[model samples]
Target chain A: MSMLQVSGASKRFGGVIANEKISLEVPEGKIIGLIGPNGSGKTTLFNSIVGYHPLDDGSIRFEGQEISHLRVPEIARLGMLRTFQQTRIYGKMTCVQNMQISKPNRNEGLMSMFDRFPKEDLARIDHLLEFVGLYSKRNLLAGDLSFGQQKLPEFAMALMNEPKLLLLDEPTAGINPTLINGLIDRLKRANEEMGITLLVIEHNMRVIMNLAEHIYCLAHGEMLAEGKPEEIQNDQRVIDAYLGAH
Target chain B: MRNTILLVLGTIIAFAVPFMFPAYQNQFAMLWLMILFALTWDLMGGQMGYNSFGNVVFFGVGMYITAVIQRDLYFDIEEYAHVAGRIDALTPDQYLTGIFLGMGVSGIVTVLVAIILGAGILGLRGHYFAICTLGLTIAAGEIASGIDYIGAGSGIVTPVFPTELMAKGMFFYFVFMVLAVGTFLTNKWMLAGRFGLAVNAIRDDEDKAEAMGIRTKRYKTMAWATSAFFLSMAGGAAGNLFGFIDPINVAFAGATFGVWMVLMAILGGKGTIWGPVIGAAIFHITQELFWTYLFGWQRVALGAMIVGIVVFFPQGIMGFLRQHWPHLFGHKVDEQTTVEQGATKESEA
Candidate 1:
């Protein structure tokens, strides 16, 4: 059964059709890759699924409940989150504080946030910071981290939420080639060890081919192809539409 | 341990000031009230990263509400305000009852107003939010002056304390001092928890905070409402002390108290626990000195001082200290080396 389902989803932006009747599925505890050329509506579909804006038409379901009409934070509270291509982190905050603040406060009362933060949670924050190999720099301001290092904190921040599904937009973008393997390793561990379902929009062909079991290709606001990673790597039309552009 | 000592010493000095400078109760009280203004302003400006110019809306609303409630309790406010504050009305009992009840009502009303206004206005980002709030403050005074019942162009006089009450200045001075302490502690408590982190996140990046599962709108509204809640009580205290509520002069003086709040907070290190306090003290003390010695030319010199501070010390006093003595603020000098390298890499990206 799918953990997330999007069917007939459509979004338009002032005479521009960003996503038109696009549909996809994210199966539980598996890694899925979304590949497309620039302006091919991959990000737009992710935005619609995560409730960044109101979709003009169609349905999105998480655990089989319609969520297309909900706002971003509400959708996040239901255990779905997305990361940006241009990383969004509190640059002025310490890395661990970022983790603590990202812990889902959906049910935390107004006053409960003021109480002493639990000791176990603090331990968990440290564990996640170390998971991202950022334990040494945890005390430094996030603004003081290199671009690639910043993404690690952002990754750890999303992990702190313990979201069942995470949509990563270009997670491997802007990192050195040497660090790409480490990120891929962490992504797989997050899926296999931690039971997170991922639907990633990746521009890196090699990273996606290595990381994904199933892949969906989007081109010009439509799902161009859906298949196993091996099948997608050999598709003729996908080669002409997206891979050629890359 | 150092913070604890400073806290104790600060409290002792605050309590002792009225008695030590017995003749200057009014000035001492004003100092405490100004601290309230600066601290509340910092909640949005420093913590939340919404530089608002209209927080005085709460102060004015609280003043009017308290005055209207007090007068309506014993006499019709319309007639009294028109009489140009010459009434010998309201026995001490009625006056006290009205003042307390008004304050209680003002607290609730101000919170409601804040939530509604914030829900509407806080949605605007950056400069629009600042200018919109500024409009709210200036418009409030103009609108209040036009209303006949609350005093129209004429101003309402607050219930004068019965002459039997002793040490008017000292009593109000201590009252404001207690209020200032309460505001400071509440802010400190908030900063020690997720509230502080969440707000700083908003300041740093609102879009990212929302993506992290924080209900950004709710946090923004709550921050503003929190500022409104305490500010209303401080307004209540200040209103009674002022004994008059001219729409422009006392209630909504955007040029004075309204502007002072933001200026004072910025003059200290914004976005830190002790920044506003340090800033308020320096601003109040310096302005007072300027007012005394500069005389007629004070505004001219004060304007230059403001310009100088903004241009040279935009980070404020605490920011300056943090840069030079980071260890005192729990930072290692080695981190600067890492930070500079990261900044260069970031710019290249």
Candidate 2:
């Protein structure tokens, strides 16, 4: 069964239609890639899905519940988490501190946060830091990390809540190639080992092509194509919209 | 470790100084309370990055309520006479508890007012929020002045209990210590928790904090309420110490004093935990020495000091200390090497 389903979703900013009639679905444990050129409503669609921007029309269902109009934090608490394209790690805090914020719990009280976590969860946090290659730098301020390293913490923070479905926006926008490769590998491992679902929006063709099991191409606030990576690469509309094909 | 020892020593001296010195020393002790009040201002203004100019509103409410209960209503000679005749000898300490109780009541009332006002004004950013709070302070002062039950502008005159002078002094001392510890703990909580991280992120960039799933408005309101609670308690304690209260001291001058507190916060180091305390101590000492010695030119001296601090030490005394003596006082300076490198890379990219 699909972990997330979007149907006839639309958003308007003033007079401009940032997203119009956009729909997609992601099965549990699958890696789905969302691609589009600049001004193609990729970020807007992500924002709409994450509840940052209110949908003007249609609905989004996460785990079979309508979440189109929920507040951002409320949506996040319900096991749907998103990372910004630009790094949003807390600069003053350590990387471990950032990850601790993402850990999910039924208790929202201050006393609960102060209560010691179970041994296994503590290990999971440490393991995730190691997974992101930031275990050594856990004590350092997140602002101290390199751009690629910073991106790793953003991913780590989103996973802290142990969300079943993750949305990543431009996960490799400004990182070096080596770090990008590491991110791709870790993301794949997370999907495979944890059985988590992912919807990623990216401009980097190499990262997207390697990671996505299914691909959706958007342009001019509309879906241009949806299929396997090979089919998307072959589609004339996608090639023209994304790569400005000859 | 050495810095921690120094802090402990400083606290001991603060507690002991009032007793060892003459009655005039109590004036200096009063100044320390002012410094504590200023530190509370910094908790909201500097550390939280909200520029508030109306902290005096809470302070004024604290004073007025304390005065009414201690002088005009409960502790008044006539009221006490009735109780004294009915109940056997009530000690002065028991009577002063009435005053402390008044302070607690006023503190709570001020918290409620602050929460409501904060809910509306704390959501505003920059100068708009500052100006709105300032307006509220002025309006509250005006309204308080007209309330005759609290003695109006004539103010309430607390009866002098010569036998209870020692008790009153100790009471103020205890009050000051409680407020100082409360302020420190609250500030520590804010700086150490996830909430503190969210606040810092919002200070750096509000939109970014929102995108990261932080409820910025809720955090701001909580900061404001917390600030108001402590600020009012300090004000109430000040009223009890003075043994009299008027609108000028409780409200009007309090508003101006709030500005001074903000200045001290900035001069100490805006976001650093101990920065405000350092700033408040230095500012209060200088203000006291100058006002005591320089007389009429004290304001001029204060203005000059503000100018000097702004021009010479833009990051304030804590920033200056961090730059020049990272290891001087035995405190570990947080090296921003990573942040510096990240900024450089961003610029290069």
Candidate 3:
């Protein structure tokens, strides 16, 4: 069974249709790639799948349960989480504190409000911090980190939750070329070692082709083509989307 | 350890001050109230990044509820409304019971109201939320003014404190001091926990916070409700101490008490535990000095102070201190080696 299934998802902003009749599936424990030109509604699909905004039409199922109507937090609790294109760490808080807040439990009750961070969670947090090469700066305010450095903590924060599936939007958008390889390794490690299924939206051909087993290409708010990385690389339609067809 | 010593010393000083002057007991009481105001305001405005201009609505509701509860408890409601605060038949025991019971009920009811208001109003973001809350306060004041049961237009009068108990100022001084301390400790404890982290996350980037599994609206509403709970109790005490509850001026008092709370939080360096406490003290003391020496020009002086705070200390005193002396607040000034090490690690990885 697929970990996540999106069927006939459509979204619009006034006169502009951001996504229309988009269908996709991520089988449990597989890294899937989504590639699209600018304005092809890749981000919009991520937003709708994660319940940032309601889709005008369609259904989303996660682990065999319908989730199109669930809000963001609710969707997150059911083992689906997403990271932003623009890194969004709590700038004023220390990196450790950021990790603590991203723990699985929403802690929605009055009693949970007063909960101290558990000692066990600290060990896991530290491990994740080390995994992302940020243990040395654990106490530093997240905002103080360089733009590339900030993304490391954000990735670690998502890992801290141990979500069944993680949605990464442009995970390597602003990273240095050297760091991109490290991030790709970590993403693969997270999949192989920790069993986190990934759905990544990437513009970098080299990164997505390296990271994703199967790639889906979107153009003009519709699914243009999808296949194995080499097939997608050679697809004439995708080539046309990237470099306008004659 | 040093903090505990300082806190004990501060408590001792707080308890002794009204006794030292005796005459300025009410002024001392107002000082505690101001501290409460700043502390509570920072919970939503500073920690959660929901700047509300209508928190005074909860305060006003608390005042009215307490007064109504007190009046209706012992005496006839119809007769009490007509007499309007002149009747002082209750003994010291009755007075104390009424105050405590009324304030408790006021806190609870106001929290419920806050939750209801927050559910709808907290959905609005940023300035729209702020403006909506301001409208809520103004509308509450106008509605209160129009109601006859609570003394429309003219305002209601709270029962007079029986002198046999103690001087009213000294009584309220202790009461408000306890209230302020409770507010401080409660806020400090809450902010030390997951609640604090969650709210701060919301403040930093609400959309990101939500995507990370925080129910942003829920946390926002909870913070507002907590602020309301404290403000309502303070309002109850204040109404009885002042002996009047003019809907616009005293109960709601959006133009003065409402504005002052926000200013005090901003002036002290919001988003820190000690910031609001320090801010309230400085702002209150400065206002008192201006009121005494500046005479009729006090408002003008206050206006100037507000401008000065905005211009020179936009981040407030704590923020200024944090910026200048990071070590004092436990922030380490990192050596250049760390950044270099980070770059090396990136390349190596």
Candidate 4:
């Protein structure tokens, strides 16, 4: 059974059709790729799947449960989370504090908020920061970090929640080309060693080919192709419509 | 060691203020009330990032509730209010017991009111929240005036304090002081924990905080209710001290107290624990001194002082001090890296 199943997902921003009958699936513990040209509905699909906005027509089943109607925080609590194309880190907070605040605890109460945070929480946050190669700058304000560096903490923050299915929206977008391989390795390790499943959105074809086993391509708010990485690379329509456009 | 001594010395001086200047007992009590208002307002404004223009609503409701409860607890409130200006004086015991019981119940009732109101209102963002709260305060004042049981237009006088036990001002002075300290300590405690992180997260980017699975509404509503609880108690204290509950003037003095609360927080520096405290102290002292001593030149000096603070120290006194003395607060300075970054940005541009 697939970890996530989206069928007939549709989203419309008034006059703009952001996603039209978009559908995809991610099996448990696999690293998958979503690729498209700009305005091709890949990010829109990610948004709809994570419950960022209500889908106009769709069913999103996570762990075989329908989740299309749920809100972001509820889906997050259900062990699914997503990062943004434009990083959404707390700028004023330290990178470590950002990592800490991003942690999802099921215990919800007013008085409980005052209890001392467990020491192990900080240790885990530091460990993740080290994994992201940001341990030295953990105490620095997140806003002070370079764009690529900010993305590292943003990814680590999603890990803080310990989500089962993680969505990466252009994770390596602004990163230096030389450092892209390192991020890809860390992401691949997160899937293999941490037992996390990843559904990634990427524009860089070479990077996705190197990272994702199976790739789905979208163009003009509709799924254009779905294939193995080499097959996607060879598909004439995928290249002419997307790779050639880039 | 030096910080501890200063803390001890500050506490001693605070407790001794009424004794040092007997005539200023009422002024001192009012000062503490101002501090209480600032502290409560900052819980949402500074901490939770919701600037409410109508927190005065809680204070106003608290005043009327406390007064009415005190009157009704032993005697007929309707009869007492109808009699107007002349109360069948309570025996000293009844007055003390009634006052304490009234305040306690009012605090609880006010908190409940805030939670319900917050559930409905905290969802509004930015100016909408501010405007909704402003509308609430206005509507409450109008509603309070129409009700005859609490004295409609002319206003109702409260049960007179027992002047025989001690100076009326001193009794109220100590009452307000305790309330002020309680509010401050409560705020300090909440802001020192995970609650503080949640609050700052809401303030920075509420959407991200929500994405992190924080029920932003829950935290916001809780912060508001906590703020309402203290503000209402402070209102109850003010009503007792002033000996009257005029719907618009004393109880719901939104124009004066409402604006002052936000101003004090901003002036002292919003978001920090000490900003509101220092702002209220500086503002209250300056306003009182100008109004009393400077008399004819009061308005000019008051305006000038506010303008000076706003323009010169926009971040508030605490923020200004933090920049110059980061080491004092244990903040590591990184000016060299910052300057290099700035130069690199210039070249990039």
In terms of lDDT, the best-performing candidate is 3
Predicted candidate 3 versus true structure: per-residue lDDT over A72-128, tens digit per residue: 988888889999999889998888899999998644675786789988888788778
Candidate 2 vs 4: which has more DockQ? 4
Q: i-RMS values of the candidates, in order?
A: 4.5, 6.5, 3.5, 5.1
Q: What ranges in model 2 sit over 4 Å off?
A: A113-125, A243-246, B1-12, B75-95, B125-128, B146-148, B151-164, B167-171, B189-219, B243-249, B252-255, B320-349
Candidate 1 chain B — worst ten consecutive residues by lDDT sum? B331-340
Ranked candidates, highest lDDT first: 3, 1, 4, 2
Docking band of candidate 3? acceptable
The digit string of per-residue lDDT tens for model 4 on B1-349 reads 9999999999999888899999999999988988988899989988778999899998988888888877887768656755545443776787888777778887899889988898899888888999999889888888899998888876668788867768888999999999999999999988877888888889878888888788788788778888888888788778888887888887788888997898798788888899999999999998999999999999888778878877888778777786677457544433332323534666887
Q: Which stretches of candidate 3 lie over 4 Å from their true place?
A: A106-110, B81-88, B333-349
Tens-place lDDT per residue, model 2, B1-349, is 9999998997898778767765645565566676676677776776667788888878878877765665544455457435433322335765567667877898788888887887778778878888887787777777778987766787665445335445456556666876877787777876676566656666655655555555567677777777888877787777766766777765556445767878788888877788887787788888888989999998899889888988987878877876577446443323223444434665887
Q: Estimate the TM-score of every prediction.
A: 0.93, 0.85, 0.95, 0.92
Name the 10 consecutive residues with the lowest summed lDDT in model 2 chain B: B330-339
lDDT of 1 at B335: 31
Model 4 chain B weakest lDDT span, ten residues long:
B333-342
Candidate 3 displacement at residue B324 in angstroms? 2.6
TM-score for the second chain in candidate 1? 0.90
TM-score result, candidate 3:
0.95
RMSD to truth, every model: 5.0, 6.1, 3.5, 5.2
Q: Which sequence of candidate numbers ranks them by TM-score, best first?
A: 3, 1, 4, 2
Candidate 2 lDDT, tens digit per residue, A114-170?
334456665677677777776656667677677777898888777776788999999
